[model samples]
Target chain A: MQLDWFTVAAQIGNFLLLLWLLKRFLYRPILAAMAARQQRVAAALTEAQAKAAAAEALQHDYLARQQEQTASRETWLTQAREEVVAQRQIWLAQARTEAEEARGRWRTELQREQQEYRRTLQREAGQRLLALVRRALHDLANAELEAQMASALLARLHALDGETRQTLAQAARDGCAILTAFPLPEPQRRTLTDGLQQFLSPELNLDFRSDPTASFGITLTTPSQRLAWTLDSYLDGFAAELQALIPPAGGDNASAYDQA
Target chain B: MTISPDQTILFEFGFVRINATLVFTWLTMALLVGSARWTTRKLSATGELSPWQNLLEVLVEGVQNQIRDIARQDPGPFLPFIATLFLFIAICNLLAVVPGYEPPTGSLSTTTALALCVFFAVPFYGIRRHGWRGFLHLYLEPTPLMLPLNLIGELARTVALAVRLYGNVMSGGLVAAILLLVTPLVFPALMHALELLTGLIQAYIFAVLATVFIAAAATAQEQTANLSQSRR
Candidate 1:
């Protein structure tokens, strides 16, 4: 085979030209694109990692806040419970005091009412006894009873002590009045005047009067001295004695006392 | 019948001549360049890829991997030259099965041009990587007396590279032609099929040998430098 120098030169030149064309068109652009793709993948991975870290930090912060809120809620609950218990105790104590005061007032009022009721009963009983005695003595009153009362007066005058007799005798000398429930006989009146004069003075002046209100009794009234023997006087003394015998009704012993 | 496409001169202008080999070479170059341009016109970095772009990327990445495997280094510097040599030869040989289409690799001139490129590339890469002095000193390795032998080995390997590729492609075509004259149908078709396999193998061999020569020269001093550093 004959080797051609021109052909060799031309073929080499063609090969070189083909090489430049292939490198420019095929190799460079493909390599550049591949490198760009790799860079994009790397950048995306880095950004995703950063976002994940931020999310984790936020989760931790939320957990911490939740824990703090739970602690605060627990503290508030405990304080509220304690306050409620203390308030209940205070209310219970005040209620107890009010109940005790009410009981004491009720007892005092009851005692007052009972005392008023007893007083009313005593007064009614004493008025009834006095009325009975006044009625009995009114029924029994007569001329004979008056005569006996006059005699009793004389006897009582004679039975008087020296000091009492002297007061009566001195008062009788001033002006003596003789009151009788019944009309006395002339001889009895003369007799009463002589007896009183003997006890007082021989020249004693006396006035004899008939008083219808004097029931079965005689009274000798002087300016400064009085001597009476009547059923009303005896009845007044009996009522006073009966009132002293009965005791007062109520005291503080029955006040309210609660155990619970 | 002409044995080589180079003998058929389509034009003559005084001393200069244009032959079938030259014309077919231009056609092959235009096909490769045009296809590359079309494939790379719209490339996507992250999204879906076109079937053509996938094919082109596979071809490029395959070439780079081969170079890297043989050279035991980065394939960037040697990629363009080596890829061109392999693509041109492979395309030429693969088209040989077509009726009346003569592969440019069948021409001694085209094979010589490819070998010559490898020859020049060895020294160019070596000198660039390790300086002229260090590159020249590689011939004297093991002993100074082996310099002439080393020089002859370089020339012989380059000649061998050209002759081996030319002989394989030309002989395949010659066999298919002779079988067409003799058996006329079935045997010639079989020979054409066989030629396809042989042509692909020859192209692979050419590309691999070129990569070896270049990588050996480029990394020779680097290996020596590393060895000496370790020793120190």
Candidate 2:
């Protein structure tokens, strides 16, 4: 085939111009839009990931705070319980000490009262015994007949029991001198001395005197000693003798003693 | 000048032709122009068509499919250029059967023009996709020492494309002409059938080469942008 150089050159120029125009107007814009869309998608995905991480962190922090609160609450409850138990123990200890002290005080007061009552009973019994002894002495002085009977007792001294006579003789031999506040004749005194001398040692001295206060009883006085055999003494002796006498064993006698 | 079967005739000023070469060139040009106009005018949004519309659609669709394979991107914008090139070459190639018509593409002048356009457009699209800086840097690839070699290689590719098309088409013509001179009856029928096959094959080769050149330019621009981003 024959080639047309002019026609071919014109056609080549047309093709070049067409490619240039399409590249300029269409391809460049499409590629730019695609790149922009890619960038937007990448940025959006990064932002979403960051927000999700932040949310997860916040959730973790919240859970940690909740756990801490629970722990703190448990601690507070434990401390409160300890305080209450300690307080209760302190109160109980105090109460026990107070009760013990109260019991001790009551025991001491009861002991003191019992000791005071025992002392009062002992003093009252001593006073009653002293009063009864004084009354018995006054009653013996009023019995005069008994004193007169005892004044005649010197004449009947020779008729005394041998044990009684020997006791008097031993008393005379020990340099004892007898003094009397009653009157006696010389012959009678001599007879009395001679009768006493038969059972007495030679160391005896006898004397006589008259006194209305003697009350018909012979009284002997020795140096630093006195012996009186008076009606009051005889009556006291007779009362003691009567009190020592036991009645015959009978139901009536025993019943009478129980009544007295 | 006088025209005879064995004598060369001069027409339209100083143009010379031995036989029907001039008539074939005019017929090829007329067919290309006519088809371009009809295809553009009858393009349907819904794709419903008459026989002529169907023929035009198939040609355009075929070119688009080839471009799609090479570019690996939308071939819509490149369809007109690739389709026009394919149709022009196909018409020129088939015109050899029209008694006195010869395909102009069988000559060095026609193929050289097409190859130079491809050479220039390849860089032009590369510069448009990247920039003038990137287009210039394509020669400096592999290493700076490879710059001269790359330039020579690009020149060789353009020369090869042009020469290969010219040689294949011209050899077909030469064979047919020689055969016609020997046995005009049985040989012309066989030669006509061979020419039809050669016409389709040459047209496809031209379109595929153009598609490959455009694809290379696009790929180079993409690589440049990737390198720049990586450096940053």
- Give me the candidate number with maximum DockQ: 1
Which CAPRI quality tier does the interface of model 1 achieve? medium
**Tens digits of lDDT, candidate 2, A154-196:** 5455476877666766665554543333455455566555644
TM-score of each: 0.67, 0.45
What value does the TM-score of chain B take for model 2? 0.84
- Which clashing pairs does model 2 show? A1-B102, A1-B103, A1-B104, A2-B103, A2-B104, A3-B104, B20-B100, B24-B101
Clashing pairs in 1: none
Q: Rate the local accuracy (lDDT) of all candidates.
A: 0.85, 0.62
| TM-score of chain A taken by itself, candidate 1 | 0.63
Which regions of candidate 1 deviate over 4 angstroms?
A52-260, B227-232
lDDT by residue for model 1 (A1-260), tens: 87998999988987888888888887787666666777878877888888888888899999999999999999999999999999999999999988897887778666767775777688777779789888988899876777777788899898899999998888888899988888877777888888888888898998998988765588889999999877776787787777666544432233322221
